[model samples]
Target: MEIYNDHKKLFTAALCLFLLLTFFVAIGPAFTSQNNNAPLPGSKPLSSLQTEGKAVFIAEGCVACHTQQVRNVEMDKVWGPRPNVAADYANITRTDVWRNTATLMGSERTGPDLTNIGTRQPGDDWHYLHLFNPRSVVSQSVMPSYEWLFDIKDYAWPNDVVVNVPDDFKKGISGKIVASHKAMALVAYLKSLKEVTLPDGKPVPLFLYGKTAAEKAGGATSKGAGTKSGPDGEALYATNCQSCHQGNGEGLVGAFPALKGSKVVLDDNAELQVTIIMKGYNGRVSEGYGEMPPVGTNNNLKPEEVAAIVNHERSSWGNNSKKVTVDDVKKIIASFDKPASVAAKK
Candidate 1:
């Protein structure tokens, strides 16, 4: 009887310990959930178009070739933003596609990271051209063309000239359209990419705050309206903009213009400065050697950062102008959607 009682007590103790361990293990994720800063679902939910496109991406076996994650050390420096966290995957649940399996979490970088491709390359026209023929833009591209994915009819030219055959499209099995609505949806999904902001509600390198010009300039007495300034502006310039523009703001002659004494920088009208920053400059028809690619393509910059940097550039390097504000940047972005005549007037 004594032996039986001891065994029973031992069994009960073991069972209680097991239950307690399991309870803590189960609730572990809840406690750690705050640390997992996942991305929110995009402003536009996964539409039927995007859903179909995702199906196409899966069917085409593109995941086998391409990856979405960006590692910390390997490609992070060049790519600007690094691999996403569990929080970045939160929005995936909203799409009903939690990508938990076969995710691009491997070490090998077979292709570029697609984490922020959508935000990095925002222009639809650029995407369309690249998809139609990769070699057209990227001279050393090794990827196969998906010309079949696109419909020649859908891409009618400006003059209503229906060109039945696109020049780059190679003949395939029965010449069936491979570029379906799914392809576009996939593109939409890709384009929706954006870099996760820092805890302070700004991008990693740049910091922004609401300040008048007077406050920024150390309470200088004379000014039309107060402007914003801080050390972030100078730091941002050094990290990103300095390489091309050079340290002293004297750009490569006949390539990048000298910011130190440029008419555009000193202009009283801040619109020109805002326009050039947002749209960028192509010197193809002009005198400069290479096009000034859009810096926003980096996808790490917020609208306010862009404004701050522009404001900094205009006000610094021996140039001075009315400070550019976040509101000003928002206004310029809105102007992009307006009619050409209205934009020109603005």
Candidate 2:
């Protein structure tokens, strides 16, 4: 009894038991469950560029502020189409080379969740601008600018992809600021962080893992509000387009062209507008606004959603032009061979 009750022996036994409990109850289950889960239907492994970008993401400590996981909660509906599940990350494993950690499921959300940033905001210009200077796009963003990942080029060659920074953000540098290879890779990695959606009626549902209090009250509904029906035009525009084009339809001066009172919005025909929105435009429509990538292509927007967005633009800002129907958008999309410049001709 004296030996069994010795303070050192008792302490050692308790410590060993604690370690065993932690392994079996916490660590062991996590590894077992992760290995057991099948890869979700649409989950794609990160490409080489994306893998390097993921390395950059880790090196930059982006995980400290942004969380990758989207909890099954009512408030989290704003971040993604559905709650994230363990199976969503089933394919993430150790790499043979470098053997860096694959899981980036962060805990803090000082920044917004990025599980669906690729689908939500895929604009290259916006991302470049934001990375160069967060406050340039988001007036009150607390995020620090990653200006180190860019280079000031005195003269851009024909093929050099120069980041188009507005004159206001250009801090007296005469040269154009272009994204470095690392910056491009990082952007690619960020854009690759898409949410995985499993096929319906799979053996196990992802929603079963992360149910919020509100979701639990409603029998653990994981589906967010945006996926109920067809895409909501106002919501879609707000998420994808409104950053460049202001809320009032008046875009930034000399940066983004004003949608309000624009000739295209008030045009008799909606063909140009539809085409420009789908394919993108790179002409000097307004001073300093030289390039506009295909918004639809970036976001992978559907014809119906594009139709709704076009109709919204035409009707809003007191410009009561003809409302574009889905069929009209469908016809334009079917004739994808139309060159952007040819269709953009006003």
Candidate 3:
């Protein structure tokens, strides 16, 4: 009996020591006088709206579904961003809120990652519409509606009279009481997401510029590539073409053909390039890599903008050619009604 009691006493003492050590260690860090050296990228201090939205997010158990920390391999390649570092967490408060380290690690991805949600789909109108009714916009979305959070306002036309809500949104509330400040705040938080820019304040892999290494290396001949297009053309090219073709015009090998010495860009005949851009391409002619979809599919780019991009590609790359005017594009578009075989034979 004495031996058992002695063992029990020793076990109690060891347990007490362990508890004391854990308490001290946890409290020491909590009370430390260290300054935060890391700052959030592209983030100002949390605004009142952001703070409120964050509270709402927690209250609604959003963290249970969404994750903010991107994994390394997921970051470097597919996601076009890096994993969250300790510095990235510096701005996030660790008090009543879950600490970046302890909140939940390796949690299942039940919902889409919210780490880069802000920049993923940016548009105030889009967010407003989506929040009003998820099923209205996305036929297959499973997200619950937070309609109570928003006030709906009647649409006003140039005459300043109220317009009826569209048939699809007829069930939705109308009037000034239909929008939610909380929803807007949450959307704002999501729109603020962006990958950390490089030390030089530029995106990584540098090929985004579409310029060849020789052009980047101060080669005098390559200097005027994208410059001749002027600001409008340059902007159009940057947004539409830079992703695949890169800024240097070297393109992504067989995936995207090089504009630097492209026969299509240099040829006096503009039909091939214009047709490909307008209607898109498929078949073995483009090396069987699959079809190029119509540029206007996004619905954001205008016909004039498409012409500008074509002009920029033709003029900017190493294959300097005569500029393609909007009038030329319009004429080509008009002629497109005829069959392709006939057009090619001509």
Candidate 4:
């Protein structure tokens, strides 16, 4: 009766209840999650450059179109090796003392999910060129060019890393495009977004309604997209090498060399082919094409992964060549003293 009748008493009780409710509903769960969850194994905290890049990623409004998360679904399998667990984002924190974007798990997915982009596209050359002009690589890309992140230099300095944008898409700009510090930072951040491998023998949650799940349930299902031997070469090619070498294997003129009917690709001996992939190729720079970064090395790819990519190119697009095994590629790699490139002789 006193609580109801007395204004002071009613206010006090309501305030206490509200505080208790908030602590129990919001604060309690958050603290519990923080204690229980940890960042995934092998997920490193951002490097200095990567941190700077993340700031650019946020400031440039990349959060509006792209998403950091890969949902637990069949389609999302393309975005990551496995569905995201709470541990995947355990390290994310508030932006600052006053602001937080809550891990930037954005709502709209206007662009491809970036969860595994690091593993898919690890090289910086393509990224730099693509950032300067989205249409340069992806003809139908609706993403706006991040030209502010580059400098148009009439004569690039010896130490400068210049981007080789295609002639057609250059829009009559005479100067060479050089990546600015912000662009370098942003690419570093983008290149850091790889999913960590789960511990051994731990059952991965099957992508829902997907072939893995269906097969596990003893239901009739189409074969999974993976190749019978190892990794799916076609999928690897699509993710890793497709940007420069167009889908049909006709590379962009004056940018990337065409793979279609290339003698190196068709050659039965895969020595030069494997070398070019393992070590970055710059021999063609004299002929207007851009230098290719050592994709296999940059991504820390396994021998099987490189072999798969090699096999894909050799067998695809009317270029029929005998596929080389992982062991064969490994032997070639062992001959080299680490992963520095050699001048590829065509």
Clashes of each: 15, 0, 22, 0
lDDT of every model, 2 decimals: 0.56, 0.76, 0.56, 0.81
Error of 2 at 229 (Å): 13
TM-score of each: 0.50, 0.71, 0.45, 0.77
Across 181-226, the per-residue lDDT of candidate 2 in tens digits comes to 8898899999888876568865432343466667545541111112
Return the TM-score for candidate 4, rounded to 2 decimals. Answer: 0.77
Q: Which ten residues in a row are the worst by lDDT in model 2?
A: 219-228
- Judge candidate 3 against the unseen true structure and give its global Cα lDDT, from 0 to 1: 0.56
Q: At residue 13, what lDDT does model 1 achieve? A: 82
On TM-score, the leading prediction is 4
Q: Per-residue lDDT for 216-279 in model 3, tens only?
A: 4553322223343323666656655554456778754334456787877888777777776666
**Candidate 3 Cα errors over 4 Å, as ranges:** 1-37, 40-42, 75-80, 94-106, 152-166, 172-177, 198-346
Candidate 3 or 1, higher TM-score: 1
Q: For residues 1-346, what per-residue lDDT tens digits would candidate 4 score against the true structure?
A: 8779999999999999999999999999989989999887788988889888999998999999999899988889878878988888887766568976357788899989998888777767778878888887888899999999999898999877788777888888899888899999999999999888877887887678677644545532211122454566777778778888987899988778999999889989888888888787887889977787777776666887788888889878898887888888888888776445333234
Can you rank all candidates by TM-score, best first?
4, 2, 1, 3
Candidate 3 has a TM-score of 0.45
